[model samples]
Target: MVNWNSLRDELEQAKQEGRYRPLTVWESRSGTWMTLNGRRLLQMSSNNYLGLTDHPDLKEAAIRAIEQYGVGSGSVRTITGTLDIHDRLEQELAQFKGTEAALVFQSGFTTNQGVLSSILGPDDVVISDELNHASIIDGIRLTKAHRKIFAHKDMDQLEAVLKESAGFKKRVVVTDGVFSMDGDIAPLPNIVELAEKYDAFVYVDDAHASGVLGKNGKGSTDHFGLHGRVHIQVGTLSKAVGAVGGYVACGQVLKDYLIHKARPFLFSTSQTPAVAATCLAAIQVLKQSDELIKKLWANASYFRSKVQELGFDTGGSETPIVPVIVGDPAKTMRFSDLLLEEGIFAQGIVYPTVAMDKGRVRFIVTAGHTQEDLDFALNALERAGKQLGLLG
Candidate 1:
């Protein structure tokens, strides 16, 4: 057998650098709450923004799908794998997004992989946001395109890159609608204007925004009110929608291209019927119910105000995702441990995920958390911060 000692050395190096995340196994999860090692705790770490993971409607849909269609699709979408549920989900997604067509992939990761690899070649240029998601970075790298990264949320730098790369066969400007780490909205209007000026294609990964920001939780495009300006809108059922899989909403031409050329969509097994069926139900809930969204924003606003009033830096956050910035990685991890002890379950995010010396304890709020829950979590946070010398 080939020696794998070098891989162990790299893993050790990652651990030493405070970048290796040994994820804590969760025993179970409820609405904005979870159990770990048999301890029930308030969950501020999950991305289930609407608390839809175990939603009654969503659960029932999944249960029915499991009973009717069985567990897995068991084949790639190209090979008798596109089930009726998958087709319905795609059609419904296209309608919901106000786009001509849509294509579902195994996940948001594979969505990027499909689109990037299909549309880009050696002569093309992909101008990406510096702080875009890791999946986007990997997808761009996989393509033969020349990847150019602009400063995080910097329109001037983006335009500069587009201008400098004068004669590429094609150009694509990619960005995250809501940056997952920092929780700030991207300047899509400016990006759209630049794309028009340079004849560049536009792509936005709205993973974090899909069920949190837009009208009836439509997403960042809806938040910014730039409906037709974006060439492609990539989103996930995993994050805010509280399900599995991902999709890209774009024009018929783009969808057609992806269907014929994207390797991930061609090779990967389609989403399970239960997952697709549940996701469709979740979207219906999003479209019809504003009550949950209102509560979600209300809770987020309250938490932000309380946390800020208590004197912790939240790092430019304007949404439910709040980060208590901790300069050192060890201290950030300690902060998380302390929060867990206090019965709050927020997690620490460290480098190389964020910049060096900018580790943070990131807390995600949802409609599921009530006023009393927020207050309880806030109280625990204050105690932990004071004990860690984060708040004076």
Candidate 2:
């Protein structure tokens, strides 16, 4: 038998470094408030941007799908699992994104992994933003393409890299629509311009921006009014859509190529009927109105301003995903614990998720949060910040 003692040592070291995260168990649905350890805590760490998780239409749709199609998709999409609902979801996604075609994947991470690995070749080159998500990093790693990194949203460096990589047969530029940790929007317009000048294609992972930005939540491309300029757009159904799965919106040819060449799509089972239905309902909900998006922005602005007034360091935050930067990992975790004691549940993010000195407590305000909820959490944050000497 293989010895597992080394694993325990590694875990112990992680714990000592304050980076060992234990799973949090919640006894209730993911809403503005959730039950944890028999106590109600204001949930500020969820990515339910539009609060569609608890929407009546989504819930009803999910139930109807379960009744009609059962609980699971029994096979991979390329096999027997391509249900009518899945096709409908893809069609809806393509229409929503204004793309010629779209392909679904198991998760946002896998979507990146499969699409990048499949599309990029050894002779090609991929230029990535330094602060891009781990999924993007892993996807680029899986590709045999020559990789180049530019500073986060640095247009000059991107242009420089593109100029330097002009010799490659093909060049692709990839970036996250919204930097998850800092909550800063990517300079996509500049990127698009640069890609055009360099004869490179653009790929944007819009996981955080999918249902949180643009007109009627059409994502970053729509927000920036660069619809057809971007070559590839990947987004998650799990975040603002309040469902599970991921997709790549691109031209029909690329979609067809990925369908055959993307290993994850071929190997993994399709999303359940209920998930597809829920996603469809979410799209409908977004299309019908922007009430939830407006409400979310209002709450986020209110909460972020209050936190900043309390002297918390919110690093480059331009959206609902706000981070209270704390330099020490241990102190960041302590700050999270302090907030929890006061009935809030903002999660502490440490190294690996962020840089060592950039540890923070991340708060994701949602549309479901009332003014009262915002005030209550702000009070809790103030108290916690004072206790930790994080506020004046």
Candidate 3:
């Protein structure tokens, strides 16, 4: 009756093909350097870009919130969900993003899903980036919108798509402000101009850029000097902020629409009170201090420079997420394993995460990583590359 054996066969094939992504348990802290499998290693794998995940302010705020409001929010925001902390965090995010309103979601993925699905329907057109995050792809799939994906950051292709979007009920140009894997910026000024020319709405998922780009990590909109023009700016507290939630900053009317129409936002339980408070604290740090963000950029620059000098192609990366494009999944895995043994935790990214033959060893640098830490990781990577026949 059940095809359990067939499913098992599929898994076996994937494992044999070197596509298995086994989770490795780490016995350590959420800091720049960590312990994995009983070995202390440099952690260059997390999305904690601004190093705020373990900040005293955020931790203390979460602790205070737990003490006062207990652990969970107990219900969906539509019911008894919106706690006091949620309201405060929303306010802070709205202010930070220069938006009239903002709404929080359970995670960045859900946030993207909510925004795309709620605003677009059949007959609507969604012009998306070819390499936008998987969550955005799924969100577009959920909508009834006709989707057209242009080449990554190729404004010409985007404009061509917009030119051809004349028959839809509405058109929305969606993109990731910072390409998560490529670490390059979206050609926003061109995209924004094209949207205006085509009378289309603009949406940006700033998951990777929220606390890495722009002044004090205000995000890509601010980075590009186009503050209020973008209709939706979706961000996650899970990345640079190091908390656990998502939000969409937009006009009051748009936020109102999502509150009523977005199923994920309406049905999902509120973020834990502790999470909301920690997010607020993280935003406060971003708003008031640039020290950590500065450190993050410094670390990124140093690491990128070293990687390039080592003759590893980083693939147009302009941020902390660096990709060592290793072509074959097996080679990528071998490179990762070699680095793992040498105490660097950069992982191999292959297949579904990226297209076939584009497998890479994706490295992430953090604000907390010291020069010494970066040097250690670089040395390990050099040896790994040599051992894997990837370099001199």
Candidate 4:
């Protein structure tokens, strides 16, 4: 038998270093509050920004879809799995994004990986933002293209990199519409200008910004008014849309290319009819209303102001994601635990997620959170920070 002692030791080491992340089960819907291990806690770390995950319309649509289409797609998209609802969702997605066409993938990560890996060859080059999501990094790694990383949202550095790639067959500049960890918006307009000057295509991963920015939540491209300028736009349905899947909104030719060439889309089974229906319902809601988006920003602003007033460091946050830097991993974990004890459910973010010296407790405010909820969370956070010697 293989010795498992080394594995045990490694786990123990991870535990000691406060990097062993154990899962927490939410007993209720991931909305304003959730039940964890029988305790009701104010939710602060969920990505359900618009609270559409449990919306009545979304639930009803899912149920209706189940009655009509059954449960699974049974086969990959390339075969017989592509359902009529999937095409409808793609049409709605393209209409919402103002793109010529859109193609959905199994997930946001797979969308980035598949598109990058399929399109770029060894002769091409990808100039990516240093602080882009890990999915983007992994996708770039899968491609044989020459890769160059520029400083986070630094246009000058990007220009320098693009200049160096002049001899490459094709150059693609990729960046996140919103930096997830630090909650900072990328300077997309500037990046687009530089890309134009350098003769490179601009690709933006608008995962976090999908339902959190732009008019009617069209995402970063719409937020920056760079609609037709960006070559490829990627977003997630799981975040604000509160559904499962990712999509690439581009021209018809690129969508066709991905349909034929992208391994993830071709190999993985299509999204269930229920998911497609749920996403469709969610988008319908977004197109009809902006109330949730306004509420989310209001809650975020209130929470951010309160936290900052408490002498906490909220680094570069312009969105609902507010991170309080605690520096040490153990201390950040302790801070998170104390907040949990106070009935808040924010999680500690440490190394591998962020840098060791940048360990923090990240809170994601949502549309479901009321001003009263924000105040309650702020008070709890202040008390917890004081108990942990994190605040004056």
Candidate 5:
């Protein structure tokens, strides 16, 4: 018999500990503002960096694609599901990243898992940054490779791991180009130099960096001018691209290898026609204009500065995703709840997502946010902070 009481007790325990994440149903399109539970709130926790999620061009492209190719791809890419739009999206992504070839997966998570698990084996080793995304962690777990994690972005520690991995048949170094929670960028140039010195391959998950860094938002590779230097690049279209799925940009040989060996690619259905077409359109938008990217950074800079000026501790953030550390889970939850009540929607980050004493309220600033919108949000935050005694 199933022990349902144990499950219920676990749920109660989680809620008491402030570890339970309840779903918020949005009644409107998730844009700069979110409509939830009959009220409109200024959205500050979304990943829609460039505000393209509700862009008319993307919506129209998706509609056109649906009318032409129907809703779903009907099968996996290796079978009869590869559409013209899929090939076009891959080509566009490769060109965007200046890579020899690119391959699309079901999502950013699956992309990391597939790439790592397929290429690595028992005799290989994976050296990762300690704060890399959970998807990367799971990807490493899937492989039989010996895993070595260095303190977050510690070049000295990374080199130590590389020195110890001399005997491994293959050494792969992986990192997130942008740390999502802290909004810090990985030192790709330094990582590349280390990889060259240690004869290891470099892989970076640029999910947060795409459309948010480099020249016209070309990502970390372009940001650091390390084109053709880094070996593997994985990114998500769901972020700034305002679409779905993820991609791997690499040399043609690796693409070919992934096509055959990556189980997620082999087993998963192809992306819907609408998703592919919409992503293609979004890429075109990215290439054609730097207006949105500039606005996004400007907004990020403004919001980060305002929050810091309010005496909030935004821990080492260099991007729009700023974390206001509250240090206590209950206080952080209270702050978030108060912000929600005041028509602002920023989620509280607690244990397991971060350390016990590092609970925070993470804010994501988007390009669509006008100065008025930002000021309004900041005012709400200030009032809430004072009321909750969070302001110093």
Candidate 6:
């Protein structure tokens, strides 16, 4: 029999270090407010930036898709799984992203893994931002390419690395469009400029920025007006799109190459028809108006300012994702638990996800939250902060 003692010991150590994560059960669809433990809590930890998960249009689209296509795409894209709706969704996504073509994947994680592993080889070099998402890091590890890391958003260090890696067969600079933990945007213009100068490929994972940035949320490339300059753009349909799956927007040649070579796309089943329909509807919804995006930003601004006024440290946030940094891991977890008791649901992020010295409770403000709801959460936070001596 396999030894279980080592796994048990690791679990015990995680618990002792305040890094043990428990699954949270929700009784309702995730929105600005959700049911947790039979209690209604203000959900400030969701990635539903535009609150489109429960939208009537999305629901109607999903229902229509189910009637026409039923559930599940029976096989992988290489075989019999590529539905007409899948093609339509890819066209819609490509148009929205202003790319020659787009290819949908199982998830944001797999998109990174498939794209990176398929494209890079032994003679290639990948320069990544230190704070890029875990998925990107894992994707890089799957490749045989030489890897280098630069300090988070440190353009000078990025340039230095680019200079050093000039002799590689292919040099790619990969970074997250928005840093999830710190809620800061990548310097895309600088990155693009440097990449152009150094003859490197610019790859941006715009997962968090997809529905929260740019003109009607066209993503970081459009947000920074660097359209067509960046080589690859990867984004998720789950976060702000209020659905599921991921996509990589690139030139037609690259899309064709990934279709033939990416293992995940070759082996895994395509997204469900309902999910494809939902994502298409989301893009249409975004094209129609910018009202939800505006409201989301407004809510984020209000919450961040108010929380900072309560003597909480919101570190370097420039978007709806706000992190209240508490240095000690145990105290950070305690603060999250206290907030939950006070009818708020913000998740505490600890070591491995973040540095041990930078444990924080991350809050994601959405368009669905009213001023009154935000005020209520703020009051609860104040009470919890005082109870835990986190405030003066």
Q: How many residue pairs clash in each candidate?
A: 0, 0, 0, 0, 0, 0
TM-score of 6: 0.99
Candidate 5 local lDDT, 182-272, one digit each (tens): 9999999999999999899999999999999988778999999999899999999989988889999999999999999999999999999
- TM-score of every model? 0.97, 0.99, 0.98, 0.98, 0.98, 0.99
Could you give the C-alpha RMSD of every candidate to the true structure, in order shown? 1.4, 0.9, 1.0, 1.0, 0.9, 0.8
Off by over 4 Å in 3: none
Report lDDT (Cα) of residue 319, candidate 2: 96
lDDT of each residue in 1-392, candidate 4, tens digit only: 98999999998987998878888878987788889899899999999999999999999999999999999988998889999999999999999999999999999999999999988999999999998999999999999999999988888898899888999999999999999998999999999999899899999999999999999899999998898999999999999999999999999999999999999999999999999999999999999999999998998998899899999999999999999999999899999999999999999999888888899999999999988899999999889999999878
Q: Which lDDT value does model 5 have at 164?
A: 93
Candidate 1 local Cα displacement, residue 273, angstroms: 1.0
Question: Over the stretch 147-247, how does candidate 2's per-residue lDDT look in tens digits?
Answer: 99999888999999999998999999999999999999999999999999999999999999999999999999999999999999999998999998999
Clash list (residue pairs), candidate 3: none
lDDT of residue 110 for candidate 1: 89
Prediction 5 TM-score vs. true: 0.98
**How well does candidate 1 match the true structure in TM-score terms?**
0.97
**Model 4 score (lDDT):** 0.94
State, as a TM-score between 0 and 1, how close model 3 is to the true structure: 0.98
Cα displacement (angstroms), candidate 4, residue 366, comes to: 0.3
| lDDT for each candidate structure | 0.90, 0.94, 0.90, 0.94, 0.93, 0.95
Question: Which one wins by lDDT: 2 or 5?
Answer: 2
lDDT score, candidate 3: 0.90
Ten residues in sequence with the least summed lDDT for candidate 2: 383-392
lDDT for each residue of candidate 6 in 186-297, tens digit (9 for 90 to 100): 9999999999999999999999999999999999999999998999999999999999899999999999999999998999999999999999999999999999999999
Model 1 worst lDDT window (10 residues):
14-23
Worst 10 residues of 6 by lDDT: 30-39
